[model samples]
Target: MTGRTPAPSDRTSRRRRAGVVVPHQPTRLQRLLARLVFLLIRAVALTLRRSLVDRTGCHDPLPPRAIYAVWHNRLALCLEAYRTYARPRSAARGLAALVSASRDGGFLAAVLECYGVRPVRGSSSRRGPQALLELTTWAERGYDLAITPDGPRGPRYVVQDGVISLAQVTGLPIVPASYRLSRFLRLRSWDGFIVPLPFARWEVILGKPLHVPRQVSETEREEFRRELQRRLLEITQD
Candidate 1:
C-alpha cells in the first residue's frame, strides 16, 4: 500500500523528531506560566496594534526573502511588525524564525505560535547548524527568515556571528530592523529588554539590506557583521 502525503505540521513534527530542533516541553508550572504570559502579550498587542515606518524600500512587492536581523530587546515588537508588514505582500510567503532551545525559549516559541509565526528552536550555542540548515530550507521555500542577531543571552546589542554566516550561506540580504516606542519600560536584562506600554506611538525602522557575497572570506564576513551592527544602530532611536 502507498503512504499518504504528509501535512506541513507533520513535516515540522518530523523535523523535531529527527533532532533538527525542538520546542519547549515545559513542566506543569512552566506550562501555566507560558499560557499566562501569552495571554498578557495577546491583550497588550491587540490593544496597541503598533505601526511601522518602511524605509527599507521593500513595499508594494516585498522581496521574496531577506534575513530579518533585529536587536533582541525589540524582538516582541519586530515579530508583530514583520507579520503585519511582510505577510500581506503575498499569502504564499511565510516566516520561520530562530528561537533559542532553552526553557525560556520554550515560552517564547509558544508566544510566537500564538502570533501565527513558526518558531525554529536553536541558538548560537545549541543546534545552531541545524537551525541554519532549517532556516535555509524555509528560505528556499519562500519563507522570510527572522533572527535576533543579538540574542540567546547577549553582550547587549552586539550582533552575533551566526547571522553573517547565514547570509553568506543562504545568499539572502541581512535586513536590520527595529521599533521605537514613545513610552516603554526597560528591564535589567542583558539586552535591556523594552516593554512598550499600550497606546504608545510606534516608529518602526527598516534599515537598508546588507548583502553578503557567497565567496566572502572570514575577514570580509566580520566586516559585514560590523556594517550590519552599524546600520541597525543607525535606525534605532533612544
Candidate 2:
C-alpha cells in the first residue's frame, strides 16, 4: 500500500483543515539563538567523522528514501548528519521532518529551515493523527521522512505508536538510526540529550529496514514499536 496524497488540493488548504495554528513569530532574541544553534551544528558536524550502519543487510547504497527514526535527544546531530550524508539523493526540497505543533516546535522549525530541511508541524499531542496522515502524504509525494519517535516529550527512549502506523500507511521501511560520540555532554533534559563536542568522532548507524505489515493487530504494532526502540538502543552507546 503506497502512502496517500493529502486530500487538500493545496498546502494552505491542508493547513486550515488540520486546524493548525501559526506558532508565535520569533522575537529578535529567538532569531539570534536560532542562528547560534545553526552555527553550532555546522561546526560540530564538520569536526566529526561519521559512518552509517546498515543493520538490514542490504549491501547496496542507502535507499533513495526511508522513514529515518532517531531519538528525541539526538535530534540536533541527527538532522545535520542527514543533511550531510542522506539529503542529496532525496527529492530536491529534501527530507520532511515531523515537528510538534507548539510554541517550542516553532523554534525547531526555524533551525531546520536554516539547514535546508523542511519541517512539517504537528505532533502526537496536537493535531496528532492529522500529522501522521500528512507525513504519509509527504512520503508518497517523494520526500524522505524523518521522525523522533520519543520526542516532543517522552518516556525517554520509549517508542510511540505513530511511527509504526506511519510505516503501515506508507509501505515505507523504518530505518532506525543513532550515533555515538567519543566525547559529549548529556544535558539534563528528559531524554538525557547529548551535545557532542567538536573533534569528537561520531559513528552513525542506519539499521536494516523494518517493513511493517499494513494490516497489523494492536499487539503487533506494539511489538514493532518495541523492536524499533531496541534497535535504536543497540547503536546509541556513547
Candidate 3:
C-alpha cells in the first residue's frame, strides 16, 4: 500500500511539531522600558567615548558603501560609536543591522530606531531567511549593512556563517571593528557583554576590509571565518 500526500494543514502541523512557532509580542510598556534602557546605555557610551577613545575613525568619512561587522558583546558601545562617528560622517549613508526576530529582539529593533540605525530582524536561529532577503534588498537600495556575526545569544564571540554568506551574496567587504576599554564591567552573560564606565579610557580599533570572493570553497570559507575571528579577538583583547 502507498501513502497519500499530506494536506497543507498536515504539513503545517508537522512543521510545528518540528519546533517552530510564532513569537510572543512585546507590550507597549515593555517597548517603552527597552527604549529607556537603550537611551541610558547610549548616553553612557557617548560620554565614555568622548573622554576616552579619540575620534579618529569618525574624522574621516566612511566609504559610500561597506559592510560593518563587530562582535556581539561589544554591541553596547558600538551602536553609539557608529552613530556619533560613522553615520553622520558618511553623510547619512545609513546602516541596516541584522537583529534577532525573537520577542527580546523587538526591544533591540526599537532601540536601534531611536539611534537612527535601521534593524533587519532575523538571526541564525530565527527569521534568518526573511531577514537575509531584506538585508540584500536594503543593500541594493544603498544602505550599509552591519552585522554582529556571533549574536542573538552566543557561544561568546564565535563568528557565524551568516556574515560570510552575506558578504558573498552582496559582494561587500567586511570591515571588522571593535573597542577596548580601560575600566569596564563585563556581564556574566554568554558574550561577556562589555559595558564601559563613564570617563573610562578606550581604544576603537578598525581592521582592514575582508573580502569574500564569490567562488570561495568550503575550506576557503572556514579560513576567512577563522581570520575574522582572530582579528576580532585581537581588537577586543584587554
TM-score per candidate, chains pooled: 0.84, 0.85, 0.83
Residue 203 error, candidate 3, Å: 2.1
Between candidates 1 and 2, which one is better according to TM-score?
2
lDDT of 3 by residue, 1-238 (tens): 5598998667767876886533334569767986888878866765674522332243365556768889988887787767665666564358899888777777777777777777888889886777888899888988889999989777778999899989888888787878888888889888888878887776777776788898899999999999888877766684
Better lDDT candidate (1, 3)? 1
Error of 1 at 77 (Å): 1.5
Give the winner by TM-score: 1 or 3: 1
Reference-based lDDT, residue 95, model 2: 82
In order, the Cα lDDT scores of the candidates are 0.81, 0.80, 0.77
Number of the top-ranking candidate, with TM-score as the measure: 2
lDDT comparing candidate 3 with the true structure = 0.77
lDDT (Cα, tens digit) per residue for candidate 1, span 1-238: 6598898678868987886655555556765776787677666777774677777776765566788898999976776677667667644377888999888988787777767777888999888988888888887887788899989898877999999988888888888888888888999888888997887777778888888998978788889989999998998886
Candidate 2 per-residue lDDT over residues 175-208, each given as its tens digit: 8888888888999888898988989888877776
| Candidate number with the higher lDDT (2 or 3) | 2
Error of 3 at 167 (Å): 0.4
Considering summed lDDT, which 10 consecutive residues are worst modelled in model 2? 84-93
Rank candidates, lDDT, best first: 1, 2, 3
